[model samples]
Target chain A: MSIDVLLQQIVNGLVVGSVYALVALGYTMVYGILQLINFAHGEIVMIGALAALFVTNALIAVGVPPALALVIAILAAMIICAIVGVSVERIAYRPLRTAPRLAPLITAIGVSIFLQQIAILVFGRNYFTFPEIIPKTPMQFGAVIVTPNEIVIFVTSLLLMAGLLFLVNKTKIGTAMRATAEDQKVAGLMGIDINKIIAFTFAIGSGLGAVAGVMVASNYGQAHYFMGFMLGLKAFTAAVMGGIGNLWGAMVGGLILGLVENVGLMFVRGDYKDIFAFVVLVLVLIFRPQGLIGEKVAERA
Target chain B: MSALLENKRNQIIAFVALGIFLLILPFLAGMIGQAWVRILNITLLYVMLALGLNVVVGVAGLLDLGYVAFYAVGAYTWALLASNHFDLSYPFWVLLPLGAFLAALAGLMLGAPVLKLRGDYLAIVTLGFGEIIRILMNNLDKVSLPGSDTVYNLTNGPRGVTGIDGLNFFGFKVRQGIEVFGHQVTGLQLYYFVFLAIAILSVWMVYNLQHSRLGRAWQALREDEIAAKAMGINVRNVKLAAFAFGALTGGLAGGLFAAMQGFVSPESFGLLESVMILAMVVLGGMGHIPGVILGAVLLAAMPEVIRYVADENVQQKVFGLVVIAPEVLRNLIFSLAMILIMLYRPRGLWPSPDRKADTGGSAK
Candidate 1:
């Protein structure tokens, strides 16, 4: 392919990769702590995106400035999604905490389907148009072109990722998160309030997921009830690719996954784009099941 | 009481009674009409798929999220070989075992590379494998010739292959709709009987499998792989056997489905179908035959059952226009049911017989 097309694909990949990175962070954080895949994390992103769409449209209808409306919508979506993440943890997942390892996994899939059904009921199974708040002006750099939305999405994702890194690395709660992850029983014995830390994990993870949701919705110009399934799946792949339990690995995995998915289309038909993620997934899993960044643990029996 | 219930004599009696009931199931469904017989056929197909998955997830402790890909493989093989897609014109009986063997081969191929992975890693890989098959199917409809311009439809893309030939049994064709007992026995009814036979055979085979030496090896691996290996079980071979057997069962059902419906499509073998089959095994209680059967029937038929009960005609206009659409409630209720069942009855609605064997097969 031409360098211009390749450069454009890279730009597009990074923009989309940032959103995937955000979603993968939720998966990475939760898996690191609970060793659960958190299948419902994808739905949180959908809920946030839809909720933001609803609030922003409503605000605009009420004559609020478009810029202010978008900001409030994002905030509202994060709060609402965080609450949802906690509730799902409490109601569906908590009961099966001590059950078989697969119990929570099944529960997560059930909740993912249940939340999708709920979204279909509330949102009427149609795509809601998310108006473009950012300008559509194309910025040219001598054969490499970009849009305002792309730049905004890339910058916004970086800021959010940076914020998450700070919260997980420098904060006291971050220490609790790390401690509880290493061994839950010991952390609880040390009076770490494991419940709060777990809940906090869900909250932050879901909030970050919401930001990704809004970014994707804005990028695509619309969002639907089932947008989370494929995206969530890819993000999970990214999380695994980068190393499931490692934070920084998630970011790298998402970018790599995104780049490969888009860039691979240059050689093959575009219709086979979805298959590339799975192909990469199986290859990575076979060669480096722990992912690129995962520290080696004793091989599972 | 324990002695009588556990006696071989009583078991024979129960088996006979079940056989007699299944023989009459079609006639009973006929009273409701042909539409219901069709649903019963589909439900039976699900039972076959679920049973195959039971051998893997239930008996062997491998969570396979892509089991339906085998079903797809079987269906497509039958359609391409027997349908208008290629006009090869093979009979249903000829294609049944062949399709199943092909699916088993696919299973072996998949299990060989990835069987070493455990738990979630295995799950993600299996899931990817499933999507890979589906996407490949979806994209193979248009294949451009190497270095040439002609594009041929291999899978027919999303349009799917059609006009699959129906089953013909010993000079009696199900599609011809034979007359029996002064009533027209439609093709659907014939399908019900044939599929019922296949279901019974699959059950018998799987039941035998669960009690055989290989089955014991599978169970040993399930309980503790390292320990099983220490006890001299070939872990890889046994796991691969479980996968192949599961695929074989799924493929048999898929080939039969192609003959019964006279059509084949990619949509039938989706991730949701895989999950629903897994749900049957999980909800019915893993490693238990009777429990798995219960799960297969309930989950497969739950939506239609809900639809039948909640149709607008049945409503008494109770809530002053707060009417709940059946489709919406069906999905919501199904999901809630999954969550609630796992929450309350993690052992499944009907647990296996072995767990109760300690107390003369009595409830613990």
Candidate 2:
């Protein structure tokens, strides 16, 4: 393979990996706190994409500048998706908090299916392309070419990750989240509102997922109802590969999965790109079930 | 004494009535168009698939998102053996057992590694395994078959294998479009074959498995893995058995499907098929054999029924607006039903009475 082609693939993988990381964080965080795999996380990403699409279209119709409209659209999408995330936890998950693990898991699947169906119903099944706000001109760096869209996706994803890390490590709410994840009962005894912390966690995770969705939709130039399904599965794999409750682990897992998938396509066909990531996940689980960086967080009795 | 006798009599009568209805279903469809019969056959195939999945997800307490992988393995095995591609000709009866065996082997291989994992981790790994198999099948065209570089096409790639021979029994061919009783009975015959397969398997295999010591062990594992393991259950062996059993059923369904369709493709066994089967298990009440059958029939027939209703333009528009317009609403409703059931009846509809009593504490 030529250097240029390899470089291009690497760049593509990075962009894709960054989005995977962003989505994986959602899974990791939710899993960390509630010990619940939020299957609906991917649907939240879809909702974000649709929400942004709607807002941008409305803004353009009302004669707003494309750039400003894009900004507003992204913001609106994030906020809306965050609220949906919090509401999902409160309504669907909370009641089943004391129920068996299977109940919540099944409910999460139901929520995911429900969200996808709703997206299809509202948007129709056809792919919706985000209006190009950023110029599509490719920048040449030696023999490697980079597009503005790719640059935007990478930078935005990193910023979001950094912000999340800071939120989790630096803020009081973050401490509460960590505490709740560690031991809900102890965290409650320490005067943390377990419910509120959980809601906040969902909001943060949802916001990140929304940003990833917008970035992905913009890069791909198309969004569809079932888009989140495979992406969700991939992100979940990323989360597990990196360690379920570990945030940075999810990031590493996502990047590794993306690179393996993209690079593996050199040997395997592109149709098997998805298969490569899944293979990595299975192998990783077999070898390191705790994940690459997963810490053992005891389940609350 | 009189009441007890009446109840026993009613139970036997109900069972006999159900049997009669099943026996006459093919004839009823033959009177109509064979399309309905074909659909019924597909529904039975789904029931088999759902029942197999139930063994893993419902009874063994393992969440497998890629149950369709076994179905693929079974179908492909039969397709390769029966098709002229490999020039290996096998009788349909022989290939059926071979398919199930291969599928079970695949299941055992997959199950062995992940026996130690639980919940979401197991789910994700299985999901990956499913995708890997699918990708391999898609790219099998490029991979040379054993001992042949003629671009040995095993799966026939995306176009899939066609011209698969139908099942023959003792010099009698069960071809589609044959006439019986002054009515054409090609598709109806296939339907009856599938129906009989499902009924026989459910009674002879699945039901028997449910009551066996092995079945109790699976349920124990599902209820509490640690407890079951502590109670002297060989968790790994039991779990592997569940996987193999599930795959066996899937393989049987796949073989029947190949015979019925006269073709098989990788596309037919995608992630969506897995989800649909899981939906059947969930919607019908997991762990309940009868409930799963009902779920499979309802979900399998749903799209076709929707298509039938939306056949007319005016009706299509109205249906689209009310029920189908928001694809999410139907999904949401379906999921909502699951959630509601989980909230109200976590044990699922028709949960084993013994299990119900055991989980009474957690049910609160």
Candidate 3:
């Protein structure tokens, strides 16, 4: 491909990667504390997109400005998905916390199916048009071109990532979270309400995922109930690529996965695009199971 | 009756009754509809699949989310070799052994890489591997060389390999129903017997394996890997054996499935199929033969039963109208059952007697 095409792919990859990073944070944070995969996390992203789609469309119909409507819809989606993420954990995961590994894993799969079915019951089984609320004007930089939506997605994702870092690093709750993740019993002894910290982690992570969901819907120009499964798998792969429990690892992993997948599309048919993330996942697990930025954590016996 | 059934007589009576029941199943099911016989055949096939997965995840304690990949391997092998896909139509006897062998080899290959990975990590890797296999099956239809005009067509892409040859013994085609003593035997009934026989063979084979010396090694390994190593068990070999054995069983089932269906496609071997099989194993009672069979039958027949029950009589009379389709309702019920069972009956619907005694039958 030509230089412009390569640059365009890179730009596309960065946009997609940011979304992956945003979702990966949810997985990494939950895994850091609970060591659970949260298979339904992707559905949270889907809910965010569909919820945003519905809210935005309704708001636009009622004479709300498109830009303002988008903002409100995203906030609403974040709140709704935060509730969903927390409730899933509370209902499906909490009871099985001390159960066998197989139990929790199976339940996670069940919860994922449950959410997807619920989504289908509420929203019909077809794709809903995600209106372009933002300007779609193309911005040309030398030989390369990028859309305004892409720039917004990338910038918003970066800002959210930065804000998350700030919250986890500079805030007291962040310190508590780190302590809880390090040793839940010890943190509990230290007067850190372990459950609350865990809930906060889910909330913050899911809210970020909501923004990512909106970005994904905006990028694709449509939203569907089943859209979350593949995207969730890819984001999970990204989380593993970076390092499961590390926030920075998830960010780097998502971008790398995104860039590689988009750039690799030049050499293969688009039908094979989903395979790239999975291939990367298997290779990474086989070669460097700790991931790029992950510390070697011992498996809990 | 209870006093009459004593000792060896009880075993003999049970065996004879089971045999008679199986013999009459096609006819009994045919009384309702031939479609029910087909469903029963599919259920028996799932019994084999669940029994195979039981060896891996249930007995060996290795979570393989890609177990269906082996089934795909066997199905595709049969599809390619026994179908007119490439104009090579191999006999069922040759295809069966070959499919099982290839699937076993794939299991070994898959086992080698993730031998050190534990639990969820192994699960994710296997899941990825399964997806890779599926994507390859979906996209390998037309593979063009870079900067070359030559293209290779394999797997026929997503449309799948169709019109596969059915099972034929010598000159007898199983698909072509036969008559005996002026009685008509439908092809579906023939397939039912074939599946039932295969299921019985598999269950017997797996039952023997579960009690073998190697089986003890697997159980030891599952309980405690380090302790098993200390006990002089060859952990690596035992794990590989589980993988290979399970894959072999899955392959056998897959080949039979392809022959019966006369078609094989990528859609049939998705992750959902793997999860479904795992559910059967878990729901029945992991590492328990009879329980696994029960689970397989219940889950495999569930959707069809739902479809039958949700017909116009129930949909219009009971619910007033069909708000949700039977397909969606099946999934909803299936998912809800999974969550609820894992929550309350974590040991499954029927826990093994030994495990029950060991844990005092506690849910935990």
lDDT of 2 by residue, A1-301 (tens): 8877888788878889999999999999999888788989999999999889889999999999998999999999999999999998987899878765666776787788777776776777888888888877899998878899889888888988998899999998889999999888899999999999999999989998998888888888888887788888888899999998899999998888787887787777677778778777878888887888987533221
- Candidate 1: count the clashes: 0
Name the DockQ score for candidate 3: 0.45
Worst 10-residue lDDT window for candidate 2 chain B reads: B355-364
Please tell me what DockQ candidate 2 reaches.
Answer: 0.52
Per-residue lDDT of model 2, residues B333-360, tens digit only: 5567666766776555545544453221
What does the lDDT read for residue A206 in candidate 1?
Answer: 97
Which candidate would rank higher by TM-score, 1 or 3? 1
Model 2 chain A weakest 10-residue run by lDDT = A292-301
What is the docking quality class of candidate 2? medium
CA shift of A225, model 2, Å: 2.3
Predicted model with the maximum TM-score: 1
Better of 2 and 3 by DockQ: 2
Q: Give the lDDT of residue A152 in candidate 2.
A: 86
True contacts kept of 1: 0.48
Q: Which stretches of candidate 3 lie over 4 Å from their true place?
A: B1-12, B356-364
lDDT of each: 0.86, 0.81, 0.87
How well does model 3 score by local distance difference test?
A: 0.87
Model 1, which residues run further than 4 Å from truth?
A299-301, B1-4, B7-13, B320-322, B353-364
1 versus 2: better TM-score goes to: 1
> lDDT winner among the candidates?
3
